[model samples]
Target chain A: MHELSLMEAVRDQALAAAHADGAIRITVISLRVGELAGVELEALRFAFPVAMAGTIAAGAELRIESEAAECHCTACDAPFPAPDGCCDCPRCGAISRQLLRGRDLRLLSLEVV
Target chain B: MCRDCACGEPAPDPAAVPASAPRELTLHTALLQRNDAGAAALRQRFAAAGVRAVNLLSSPGSGKTALLEALAQRLDPTRLAVIVGDLATDNDARRLQAAGVPAVQITTGQACHLEASMVAEGVHRLNHQGISLEQLELLVIENVGNLVCPGAYDLGESLRLVLLSTTEGEDKPLKYAPIFHGADLVLISKIDLAEAVGFDRAAAHAAIARVAPHAQVLEVSARSGAGLDALIEALGLALPAVR
Candidate 1:
């Protein structure tokens, strides 16, 4: 799946950053995954060890934090969470045309020795 | 009961601290930073070359190649070029070439989507074939046949075209919201078979409106020569004088 490739990107950046900071070994890799980022967390977990093998983060623990999807209603000018995958405004029942957040897949922090 | 403070219960030895203790490093970075940077560079290049590029994405058998083939006949062959990507084989490229268009194929061994680097390589190959980006009015990149992965990649295209055939069902847009939401133009392909296949036009249009409120939807049939002119006008490729 594409999660493997995405994890490879994570591994590359983690190794690069760990080395740049004069760290010996990585202990934890922290990530911020959004609900609407088009990635499956289960698939990402499955790809983590495969992508991190033979690197400083070989045995590192993967910590993922999820961000909920949010949408902005153009007609009602309201911001609401899209937990049910519906893009309609809760305030006025108008359709939300703008997506404000919850599409991020970021490496937030890392712990290295 | 602190260990190293003046009001602590016990004093700590300075030598007891581990020298190689772990450190927390804040490196808030996007996972696709590298790909996004490549896309930004390519976008600058396209803008400098005055070329309009469109990235097409769809599921397998969604008529992406067919739409391009139809476009080849309508657009100027000398000014238009295409770069196609697939898991294997250059058959799509050959098909477009046979339809009288300059086409380059990038056969990604295992990748489900075309990254910016692959597009750059494809452009290089097209240039090697004497089709420079500067001379082209429109450059179409037919991404790998996928609905999920391609939605996350930006290949420096001015427009993002997504296709959904009549046979794919009406709820596809909502099911694959990420891809459809990112589309600048949504083409409902194989409209000629809509009536025969019982494709609910109203439901499909409603689904598209729900997911992609800002996208312009066009119903097209590559075989029946329906909506091709509108597709060309929507792309705003080039005029005869410019050619």
Candidate 2:
């Protein structure tokens, strides 16, 4: 799965940050996955151990925060939450063509010691 | 006089002086930062070489190769080249070469998507095959046959085209909105079989518009060569003057 490679990216970044900070080890990795990022949390979890084995982030707690998908309605110029991948505007009866957020997959913070 | 082994340094505040305490470092960065950087570099290279690259994305059996074959046949093969990605096999590359164009095949093994690094490698292979990027006008990267993972990876293409076949159902766009949302052009492929497959054109158009209103949609059939000219024109591929 692509999630495995994503986890490897996370591991590489986290270890680098920890090393730069002169930290001995990483304890927790916090990530913010957007709803429309095309990433499955379960898949990320399944890939976590495989990607982190024998690394400084081994056995580290993985914390994920989800960002809700938002779309900008082209007709009404309003932003609304896109639940279930439906970008239909709640303010007006218009399908939103602009996506405001929700495609982000960010590594927010790292807990190191 | 200092307290707690502080040599006159205002007695190190106890509230903030925790020994061996874990530190939380904020690093707000995209997960695909490396890939994004790589893609950006590729874009600059393509611009420098004066080559327009287009990335094709679709599920398996979506006729991506067939559409490319038709386009290759129409365009000047000397100025056009293609890079095909598959889990295993050079079948697509062989097909495009047989159709009269320079082609490179990338066997990704188990990867479902083609990353920027892979595209760079494929470009190297294309060079080894006596095809130079500066001599090409259009370079197409046919991504692996998956609608999901490829959406997240940008291979430094000038345009992104996604194909949806008539047999795939009208709701396919809505079901896979992420990939469709990122498309610059959406091709409704296999139109010659639409009637045979009972494909609802109206519903498909509606679904595509609902999800990808910003994308220009075109109906095409590689088998009959219908709308291939429009597809070529939309991609800004100019035919040879003599042809």
Highest TM-score model number = 2
Pairs that clash in candidate 2: none
Model 1 chain B, poorest ten-residue lDDT window? B234-243
Clashing pairs in 1: none
lDDT of 2 by residue, A11-40 (tens): 999999988998877889999998878888
lDDT of 1 by residue, B146-185 (tens): 9888988889999999999998988898888878778899
Q: What is the DockQ of candidate 1?
A: 0.58
* Winning candidate number (lDDT): 2
Off by over 4 Å in 2: B1-19, B239-243
State what share of the real interface contacts each candidate retains: 0.66, 0.73
DockQ, computed on Cα atoms, for candidate 2: 0.58
Per-model TM-score, in order, reads 0.92, 0.92
Task: State the displacement of the C-alpha of residue A22, model 2, in Å, after optimal TM-score superposition.
Answer: 1.3
